[model samples]
Target: MASESSSSSSSSPASPASSSSFLTEPSPPHSPSLDATTSSNIDIPVLISGAGPTGLMAGLLLAKMGIRSRIIERDMAPTPDSRAVGTHARTIEILKLTDKAVYEEVGSQSWRSESMRFYFGNSLVADIKPKPSNDSEFHVPWMLAQTETVKILTDAYEKTGMGKVERGWELLDTKVVEQEQEQVEHQQAEDGTTQDVKTTTRTTSWVETTMRRAIEGTNKRKGESVVLGTVDMAGEDEDKDYEVKVVRSEYLIASDGGRSTVRHRLNIPFPGRTRDYNFILFDGHVETDLSTSHITFINGDNRHSVGMFPIRDNRVRMMLDDGTLTQEQFNAREPKTPTKEYFEKLLEETLGTLKLKVLSYNWLTYYRVNERRAAEFTHKRRIFLAGDSAHCHSPAGGQGMNTGLQDSYNLAWKIALVLNGTAPQSLLDSYNEERIPIADEIIKFSAKTLDNGVYQGWLSSNMKRMMLSIVPFLVRYLPNGRSRPPFSMLGLRYHENSVNKAHKSQHYPVTGPASIGQRAPDDILVPFTAPADTSVPRSEYLAELEEDLTDQPIPTRLYELLAFPGVFHILVFAADRLAKEKDFDCCLVKDVDHYQRIWSSRWPGLRGVLESNATSEAMMCKKMKSTPQFMVHVISSATPSSFESDPNETTTTALADREAGFGKVYIDCEGGRLHERYGFAGVSTKKAGGGIVVLRPDTHIGFRVSNVESAAWVEVDEYFGSILVN
Candidate 1:
């Protein structure tokens, strides 16, 4: 009840418990900054509907990219219930870039649980912890309530001047106000001639968004004053609270929940079933006989199917079946929000002698699980759907809120780039192409887990029962695949995606461990100290360094290099000292210069600017600023000693780091494990080694130049050339 987490479990356990275990986390800094934008000036670059995790996260991320967005919530405030509870690894990685405190706050307040125990009444059925620690930053998954997460995200978002959630607003109507199509304007001759002149004008497409104040009397309007109360001045029961405003924007994002008004208005079909099987979920103080550290699923052959977790403040979160409630009893609870008594009696009877007393209930919900997905995610490339609007499913794996946040993430960068005029408009289309299949996968996965009552279906309880007897045996031979990278979503791929250029000669197989389209793993790096020079500003030299990171076996992490302003990250994993020296002499030195020469010097016409005879330093610097900025992280297998020893090596590395804008140099000299992990199998001097890996702003790999040669740089040039204007 105190924390927020979208809870997920690895085992189905003949029960769909949605319970989350959490430690008491410190509350967010006490409203350090109040929301400044109280005016109803909804005119912004991006307007986000539904201020849930998806919308809040979208607004925050867009702000990081210097894009301002107005997030509108139909409700007056954040959700009181613990909606989602599990913060997976990839999500934690993403949050660390935005604000490390969120990651730390969420992690501290939640229990890190790997295995969940299942019992049939008092009898033990299976104790299963399918996933194990791998390359993830956090070894085990952290569990915080979803509400706490919302507060952290919301506070962090509000702190950014970009936008804040206008809690009293709701989407009333949306339409294509303008379309980017040619229109012919006909004008009669001034002399009244028989012929008329015509001019063709091209109009850029945009959406006209109309939103009304759903909640009464809490909005500050900018332009015209509308009715402020539910009752009008006449008191004739007219809907006086309906204050509507129509604003136009280049794009609109619908992060609205399952019954998304934006999705409905766009005519996107959401096809799925609302299962008859209903469940009662409640969070309250429970005196129970269970471990306080882990999630337990008390389940079995349709007898006592329940899930219990120890949450913050000595309270517990529990979920169980509807327990044969009559249709009359079910319908009695108006709005489907359950009563406290409905859950107390059920918990008492189910626990029997286990001693579970629900002293007080914080929130109660009766939900009929539904698995559905929108047929498409975007409309006319102007209006986009995300979060529950795009895809919704039974909360089996806690993928709902997490996936929604990810949807906002995947689309945010593309929108930023396209709007920045660096990327082609077609880049926006990849959001649908990539996310739909992922939604489909989760929907199928959720259905099987929800119907775990009898074990006949996939993820059959029977299979778990049999596997339980030999779990230790299974763990030995099995790759521990279930709870590993794939389960945590760190292994998600978009290699077959149109936006990715990974199938070329140099790029490794997308299926490889750290290949194209996969979440780039975090690796440790040792800092190389340059010669003490009072002239060089050390803090500003490694200026891109993040403020939040603390102690470690190494100084910085690979993921930290990623959380910058929205753009591509080109990591040139140069080989060892001698090899890098050779590689630098061969071509690494000219990579940035080549792009600069092509984009700035020769191709000024690409930017639609007239060729200038004025080529001063300031003029060239201004011209260079216009091109797409891709951060270059040159990670080498060499140690600081190498650069300290060789003058040529020092000069090359320094030139790349400072003069050429190749990012900070990081060392991974410990057997080059990071190099090997990224599919650069070996990078010794004798070996024909090293390659280039390109990562998107969202940290997904886009392409790789595996063949690290002088000529191989052209492939990279071609990759950016296709999508970027210059």
Candidate 2:
């Protein structure tokens, strides 16, 4: 479905001879000219007007939901340019829900190293590692060309067979007309009952057409289909259906881009100011022999900055200089100051005269950095905007493409729901309410990065050099304050909603309101019963547990019990009651002694501190000393049966029984009457029996536990408790 090949050089216009074919196709199955009553019977639920990554992804998700969509694109074929090149961990997790193969394939092609070194004039100032912590769930950022990413998405979309993208079709206009009934006279029958006669009324129609010449290779002109229009945008009351005039579906999305035609038609202001900065993007095959595998940023001169990211096999992507340039200057036929020459000078100035050679060129483009946010992303209830249409900011953190793709992903599902009449129109309001704030935040963050100037100054150059020399030591030992930006895809969350509000205040720390929808960090090793019956060795317990708990769900009751509003949960496991008893009996110690030792050691000063302040002593003690007791009560679904004699033996037997009945209980608990009310699903498998699972309000697991003494467990709890309470 997605194949890469050499780009064709031909750029011919459509020929007139092909006009007849465009006009002669069979009438659409449900044309606008048909009677409104008859047309209502056909099921054409969704119509998308773009086939880029966002549109394709939305279509793919719709297909997964068993819904059908038609995508119309103005492009005659897919673009070969490799635009946005970074994929965050959060996107990978979202994709995993519908297409694991695509996730795995894309993940296998990510950049794993931590730091990105910048060489500036006689100095190396900033050694930036976007996310430096090894404890993060998404430890690496992926760098793949936008073209390739779209190719993968297209392949996945086609496999669904529930949708098809029609290239070359464009949207024209939309009009709405109410269906009316004809007046008739009433006649009295013999029984004195009035009989009404029915008559046909005029039906209003919304016509949509596509120009055959607009998409053809030759200058051929022909008008295409006139079909009924679906809701392009909905007003506050979605129940009241309206028609939109679509002249060309292919170009419909252009109105959503920054320079929106629809906005112009409606006389709406875009309402954002553009910053005074420009960025030049160059994509080409280079002849450089630099052996370094990591991305290189050259920052020395205050006037310009250079960033080089590895694309596919041999090609690389480079962004240089900032600020706007005229079209003539950008596309000079003679190429007096080429990108290669610019990079060479930058490398020499920053790295102190390093030998680098230039090879061939592929594509070159320039963009002015515009830090603007739309006043509102929707208008008049008939038009909605997403991606660049809603917000545009500097590409400093490589967030532009990822952010746009995610925007489309969020909108597609809601659109499908509205189209299918499953969700109320109010759901649509959440889009702007949720995403506009994020866009503002992104713009602010990008502005900060721009202000840093470390990516283009002498101080930054020196700092980068020094950091690169000491990175090995810094990464191994002092990794606390020296981490990268927390720009995880999973870090994004929808907090201003009822569903998220129900979560306890301290349930998901690293991934609460601040990090909702983010992938839970991989650092906290989770110990779960191995799905297979093979005996787990003590030495391999933590390692195997980490592997088993990688993507498991956090238990729902955990969030309920913590009772924190829109916060994260940190669960600490103390010594297993049965194991502590065994140790006590073997050493002839009292139960209280064992409890004190386990509580003091695992939870340490936290208990004493809480006890000193009477306000929290009971809760602290319960969390530290009596967790197992609380666990017994919460794990009621396991229906754990305890025996006083040989506590370890009894606990082990009960665990086995719970595992045996796991599937049924999990289904009933997560899907039965109880699960529906609570909105909590059991962890997918029964393997979660003998551990503590930190759950988010959304029921996603953030961390898990088996042994109480593990440092990871302690860290998880501390992290969970440290989240900001909002």
Candidate 3:
């Protein structure tokens, strides 16, 4: 086999490969971009294989956390077809929280689908809509083409100044290696000359990946550079040869679709089964008598069903189950054109009396439903499997792409923390512990949905019809009618782990609307007066607040404060009863001093390196580049009038003067909404008394304590201590 070494770093050579027939010695010269000092060498912190939504999202999250990553896509150009079109609510929340611009672009360009209508034999049965939740603003899915989603993420990632996706590059293999390396630093002397005066030896482990240029040239359309879309059918060059290269990186994330090369190369068994059912999906312009505003499902004779999803401007995606043959027979059949006549006939059979005319088409394909998952999400703690690489199942609920996007979101922050020395290497283990279970649940959920709705038998068909008949009523009146499983994905949560845990205090139980590992609910809050305006009398400021609240800086949402990247949001709720008690300072802002130190400590440079005995100021400067980890916010149950003239001047001393641990502080102005949502309203009356909640970087509740006293502060410190490093 022909291969090329990308790195000239003789000190840190590519790790030895596992015994495989594909392994071979270097043959071709290295590509200029892959050389040691350039793209693929030790300087790169992360190497992501697959530029699909998952891989692109991973790169974006890393960039948001102030870490740089390289993404390589095997395909030279994007496919014209929109493969996965349903971007779910939870995925929207993740995008909005991490990058608002990307979220806004998607919201504006995509179709927002909040309701779905189901019919049986031309008779409408159920019209279902998701219930809105106080925890998130998004309760509907965004129906955008996968191609468009990739373009948006690509644009946002490129704008970060990190770099663009390296298209046509394919990963062949990977192996983990450990070695001691020398880090050389050049310092300017008094003579105005640079000298390599500092050299440090550090032991590090990295994944050495073998990659190659599988294709060449950008896929352009009509002489315009195509940022994304399907491969150009007219640009075929079968005679071109390929070049191979090997590069070393600290971490490797595999998101290379269901048939992942990285998964196969590692010999990881994808244990699962493929069902006999076959599905035909096509996107096209269509004219129909049916309502095209929301997703619609029609069931006809022989248990056959078809789903229609609106794609903007008269375009609709049609999916139908083809029972003409088993999956095996369908796969073995001779190739046939998916002509308009053929699809029209298929829809006529599935739609019964309903009529639809296929005017034109862009893409069409067929596939068998396969349920599979890797045995391990991570290998050797250096290589990770994400998206379809880790697990895949039926696309019945339009959850495939959304699940993959979340997988990257879950893993990115942990990797960033570990790489930046903010968290221990052990922190990475939580990725598998948390995401694998979610993957398994999604797999089971989608499989059941496919069976009940599309590929149903006689018994299941009757049961599904009965269920569909009552769905409208249940959805309208039921308490949990809003966010259903596998749709909103709001209920997905991690179990207690190193980063997600309950308090060690035995005196009281941590009670809240959401558990320790669930999503933190969102609520409105009134911002504290600006430092300059804090001296204004309470009566004077109240009038300004009433007129043009926006100009006076109106209320803020809980998520708005939590959106800061890679930082733990500590919500300190000062309950009303506790605030009215004697020594209210002790109950409210007593531990603000301790939190300030912990918050400032996140930046290693500002704190002077907690464990550093650096020889010079330059050495100290390097450590200061570390990213901050925690942001503390104080929410009080007291009124806006309690601030100015109070004897303690708690708001002035703790908030306006010190910045409240360098984070925002707000008041629960809306009839104790924030307090009740966090289960802190009655906390003062409880045996243990509690009001502290810690939200992880991903917005899930990581930890909570019963009180904000000195002891509770210790518990909070220990919670962070479990995952973060000094």
Regions more than 4 Å wrong, model 3: 1-41, 179-203, 214-239, 324-327, 336-339, 479-485, 505-513, 530-536, 540-554, 577-579, 586-590, 602-627, 639-653, 656-663, 684-688
- Cα displacement (angstroms), candidate 1, residue 385, comes to 0.7
Over 392-451, each residue of candidate 3 has an lDDT whose tens digit, in order, gives: 888788888899999998898888777766677788888999998998989999988787
Over 1-726, each residue of candidate 1 has an lDDT whose tens digit, in order, gives 122122222222111011112111223221111111111222466888888899888888777666788888877777677767777676777777655555677777877776667665566666656454335565455677878888888887787787888887766556654323333455667797655445544434555666655334543323211101111112212333444455555578998787787877677888887666668777777666666556677653435467766567666677777654454565575755667776666666666555666678777777666678999999877789999888888777667887888888899888776765567678888999989888888788667766664224335555656666576456546653334633366767665566676645745554787776777766665544343453554443333222212234345556655555465677777767432454554455566556545643422321221111112221111233322356566677764444433433333355333411244456663646678778775666654468877787787888787755655667777777876655
TM-score of each: 0.78, 0.59, 0.82
- Candidate 3 — worst ten consecutive residues by lDDT sum? 605-614
Clashes of each: 19, 64, 10
Candidate with better TM-score, 1 vs 2: 1
**Sort order, TM-score high to low:** 3, 1, 2
Model 1 CA deviation exceeding 4 Å by range: 1-42, 123-134, 179-201, 214-239, 300-302, 323-342, 453-462, 472-486, 531-552, 577-586, 596-628, 638-644, 647-663, 686-688
Please tell me which predicted candidate would have the highest lDDT against the true structure: 3
Among all windows of 10 consecutive residues in model 2, the one with the lowest summed lDDT is 606-615
State the C-alpha lDDT per candidate: 0.62, 0.44, 0.69
> Which structure among the candidates has the greatest TM-score?
3
